[model samples]
Target: MDQTLTELRTVNVIRYVTPLREGGSMPAIVEADDGFLYVIKFRGAGQGTNALIADLVGGELARALGLKVPELVFIHLDEGFGRSEADEEIQDLLKFSVGLNLGLHYLSGAITFDSTVTQLDPLLASKILWLDCLLTNIDRTCRNTNMLIWNKELWLIDPGASLYFHHNWSNWKEHILTPFALVKNHVLLKQASKLNEADVFCKQLLTTERIESIVALIPTDWLKDEPLFESKEAQRNAYTTFLLTRMQHSDIFIKEANDAREKLI
Candidate 1:
């Protein structure tokens, strides 16, 4: 599965659907011209385009690591849409989001995964744990797994919380090796196995070219005006540098994860 995935397709928002007010970002379920429903993350949301950047990079990386992820796409919004009757808050959100937005394919009838009620294969659990650590994802705890069980398989979602360094560029270099301590509380930590093996697999698979491919998926406008970066490509390169450099310290994260796993046992 080392092949590059096709670039995400852009679709026009054919209809303004209901709001899915689960997270702070105010993502909505909208119908696209492709006749498919997508969970679109609006640029007007709290995290703004940076959250979309994380979703593209993290989701693509997860897929490359052989984990299931909803197909990522660009959903175009229109200003006139959703102008009619609606909650004032949602009306404001839709109005501001009159441009390109990040979307994850909607999984109809999919159930939120509850790790407590179900068991997961140790290797699969380890793979997900390793992926989350690589991305420095702090949002995958039991309190909010951010995963869906569709057709009895776990699909990872919501990687917008990673790359936290972007939010504050000062001393960003220090974040590369920042050990992912929050992983100790991850919902699937107890079920993880072969932690060291998972690290090696990710390090080998998540190469520079692969990372570039993932970053390239992000539109240029989204990377603009990023602090400490002059051009869009510069910001993109910063992400590549961070992830690639972080891989050099994979053992530190692996050891931290294993230590936490021991505490769980």
Candidate 2:
């Protein structure tokens, strides 16, 4: 457990159990020295470290906002841990990711949240929907909620699609006031009856200082090779700046959410 990173723990991978190839990343279930199973996010994943960074920051923000999220850890990959893997893909991924990677503690027996089969408290739904809007996350649609149900509670997962500004920082200004109209397609949109309230609460929590701290959580190794920024520090500044600006204009998104809610409800 690194003291600098606060509550986020660090664990070493003990064994690679299996590959979860549902997504391009091909994250795997690996047993950690901590005696827990974690869905490992490989650095070699197609999206590269961008996806891992997004997952780390977005999931942490969710937890900070009192949303249910799985425990995230920094898992150190041993040099020879995946050498004996039967799958060439997994072996290659493991070889490339023989360093630090992201891991979500596996929630055994957790079921995927299906709106048709379950209903969430309106406030919870609004809070989640608001966070997605704030992060500009485009992956939480009905077709792909990226959510799970464990212990009879909704838990967020797979936040890799967030912080879109990093992908196209060229005209990030044009994107700041960008209306997240796609939020209407969000899985929780139907149940987010309190979007306005959620917006206020989240805006208060996501202050500039908080945004800066969250961006600092990104690993330095992941901040390299950027086409837009000159250095990792610059990249970190860009993230916090983008998020701080977005937080200022949250009303734009809140209105978009409420407008969408009006049509749905």
Candidate 3:
């Protein structure tokens, strides 16, 4: 993938359609000025902008690795955008999220993926499993999957729970090269038979330049007031360093995941 293609298109929110209550953060479906509906992740939601950062980094990383991820857009929520909303909680959320937010292009007519019903190719399953491990994503369990079957193909979504280390930067360094033991509970763990091959393919795609480019997509406002770093640049560098280091030590996580898979089978 071309490094220059990392820029996400920005769209102004034209209408607030409905809130997705299933998510703890209460993400909403909104219509953008571009005439498309998006599942908007508010910066002011309970999870805060860290969740937005995770979505941006994780979604873009999946794209770079040739995985299926919805198109990400920077959503501009003009002041007083949701003033007419009757729900107090939603009104407060919209009030705080008056500036930039993150959104995924809404996948209409898509159904929640059922791992038991939908068998996946082993290599493809391995790629998805490997990605979740790399991001330390804890949301893709059998109960919630966080996946969709759109147009007869599986697509990944809702990556906001990833990169939990960023929420508390105090022990961030200790997480580098750490094995993601949680992979055992992944929805597709049983089908991910080609993890090593998936690792090689992903490593070749997520080069240092590509990783830096993905981290650079994070908006500055979201990085502001971070207590851990002096500047947004430092914060970005920390994320890039963490991901690259983890990739270098991919064997640790791969072995961990394989071992976990062994127990299940």
Candidate 4:
């Protein structure tokens, strides 16, 4: 474990609360102390240990990818509140309840997919696609646009569906090959000059070393009995390979956007 993670456990910033929503693999929410907020996720025996590891690994990887994800930490508590009598489980449930209450009264402003990303912003759309590709995130679809926009910035939330690629990876590949027609003719891709800037940004953010490091930080339990390579190093290499492969496929969409732009002119 990283030393920073150990120190983060000691901070008294986290407060467990009740859930605000119910769609994620595990229930969770952000508890704030003063102005700072910490994302707290509850792990019950019902979810099993593997799910907990997935959450931690996915959260860490998102942060490494330069995406706007909330800060996460494990909050410990005494048993007797939920199943297994484990303090960890009890603390998680408490935090979830608190988060639900807070979101209901306070952060009532909600943004839906109908108004998220406009069809004109092909460059921004491409950037999002590239990030999703690198992370093997298969849940960002038309109906469940998990990305939220508040204060003019995009924030990623509810990643409980990522990393378990065995379930949705095939669906993701099908979509990537066909491409989303709506974003194909976006204006941002029309300007070749703008793509150079986006390409640069992507290159800077998704480095091989950083990807490998993030994969290493994922809890080993999440990969249990999965068809992936046995060793951690091998698993990291495999994940990196998957990300690169997805990026290659995404390039075709970018090219299509460029072609559409040329036709328009």
Best by TM-score: 3
Question: What is the C-alpha lDDT profile of model 2 across 1-265, one tens digit per residue?
Answer: 1112355789999988888878678899999999999999988888888889999999988887878889999999989877788888788888999888999999999988899999998888999998898788999988888999999888999999998777767887777787799898999999999987888788777666666777888889987666777787987888887778887888899899899888998
Candidate 1: Cα lDDT at 208: 83
List runs of model 3 lying over 4 Å from the truth.
1-4
Cα lDDT tens digits, model 1, 1-265, are 6567688899999876788888788788889999999999998888888888889899999999989999999889988776883688888888877888999999999998898887888888988988888888989988899999999899999999988878887767898998889889889899887887777777788888888888778888887585577777887888888888888888878888999999989
Q: Which stretches in model 2 have alpha-carbon errors above 4 Å? A: 1-7
Q: Encode model 3's per-residue lDDT on 172-242: one tens digit a residue.
A: 99988789888889999999999999999999889998998888888888885667788878988999999
lDDT per residue for candidate 4 within 187-263, as digits (tens), equals 23332335545555776665666555655654454444544446755654555666556555666655554565567
lDDT leaderboard ranking: 3, 1, 2, 4
lDDT of 3: 0.92
Q: For each candidate, what TM-score against the reference?
A: 0.96, 0.94, 0.98, 0.58
Better of 2 and 4 by lDDT: 2
Looking at candidate 3, what is the lDDT of residue 195? 98
Q: RMSD in Å for candidate 1, one decimal?
A: 1.3
Best-to-worst order by TM-score is: 3, 1, 2, 4
Model 2 backbone overlap count:
0
Give stretches of model 1 more than 4 Å off. none
User: Which of 2 and 3 is the better model by lDDT?
Assistant: 3
Higher-lDDT candidate of 1 and 4: 1
